[model samples]
Target: MLNKDCHHNCNQGNCPFAQDSNNANRYVCLKCGVEREINRYPSGFGSIVMLLLSLFIASQLLINWEKQDNQPQSEPAISSLR
Candidate 1:
């Protein structure tokens, strides 16, 4: 069974984990341990994905802005006399 005191941000007023720790029990805190493990070795995929997503958004905005700014020039001011 998991120690209630070891839960992430445990706030139970009567958690045994806190009492156990206070009594000098050295059992590891699984919640904090798992978080540390994940932080210590997060996957590279997320970073790559975020970078690509931002670049794609910027490119799309640029394309839209360019289209808006590139209005065609008006026809020649003078045409052959009818």
Candidate 2:
């Protein structure tokens, strides 16, 4: 039999899995009784590769902008009237 408070709501504000279990066990948050696992942050070489790729894209965009800014505009040629 579940406790009066053990009527696991699992609602948005009341996450049953996040609460203390019968055996005093800690569980992850749940959405509508469904258990949710905590997501771990990226580490190791994957993070490094992502950082390098982002930097390369940013640098390329910056270089393109600089080139466009430095480009010179041509003036229209005027003809002399006889």
Candidate topping lDDT: 2
Give the residue spans of candidate 1 off by over 4 A: 1-41, 72-82
lDDT of each: 0.54, 0.61
Per-residue accuracy of model 2 over 1-82 as CA lDDT, tens digit each:
1234444564335654665464333355554444443334435667899999999999999999999999997888898999
- After superposition on all CA atoms, how large is the RMSD of candidate 1? 9.7
Give the top-scoring candidate (TM-score).
2
**Candidate 2: Cα lDDT at 51:** 94
List, residue by residue over 7-78, the lDDT tens digit for candidate 1. 456344332232234333233343443211223434587799899999999999999999988978678788
Residue 68, candidate 2: Cα error in Å is 0.2
TM for candidate 1 is 0.37
